[model samples]
Target: MFFLSLVVLDPLVVVLVGLVRREGIGLAGAVMALDLCGNWWGNWHWLRDDPSQLLRLLPLTLFGVFVVASTLPLHRVVARTTARSETALPSA
Candidate 1:
């Protein structure tokens, strides 16, 4: 349940990341995954179209982890850069 929300949440986060960073081919895949999951919960037609149900489980979860793996490290990099930049600045 928590993970589901996190996965759904990440596309939004990464959309901002992509916009700020100006890149999104892979993150766009995450959005598609969100669409699959969203559609599944939204109606019965989704299952009739994609009966395998892989969308809600393996792929989306994997993409979510991938998104987190890709972004969390980037966050650390940004934080480290910001800290270094701040320390290098002289006090006013």
Candidate 2:
């Protein structure tokens, strides 16, 4: 249950950050797909060892980790970019 929650929440965090930063829908979509794919590939070896036990949960777990990973960086990038844009804008 904890793991399942992590899996579900992590990606949501990423999407939230992306939306806050106003990232294009296309880029966000790509990021999500890549995040999921990367997680699956990274964990495939471990999951294979106990295919029956972990296979069912592997996709969700991997996705969660991916989202968590993706979100952290996105948050930082968005913050920095937002700052830069604000600084660049002319004074009112």
| Location of the lowest summed lDDT over 10 successive residues in candidate 1 | 20-29
Instruction: Look at candidate 1 and tell me the lDDT of residue 45.
Output: 70
Which candidate wins on lDDT? Answer: 2
TM-score of each: 0.41, 0.47
lDDT tens per residue, model 1, 5-24: 76766667567665544234
Residue pair clashes in candidate 1: none
Report lDDT (Cα) of residue 58, candidate 1: 64
Regions more than 4 Å wrong, model 2 = 1-15, 22-53
- Over 1-92, each residue of candidate 2 has an lDDT whose tens digit, in order, gives 43465476557646765567545433454556655666667767877786775666567667656655575576677778889989999999
- Best model number under TM-score: 2
- What is the Å distance of residue 47 in model 1 from its true position? 2.9
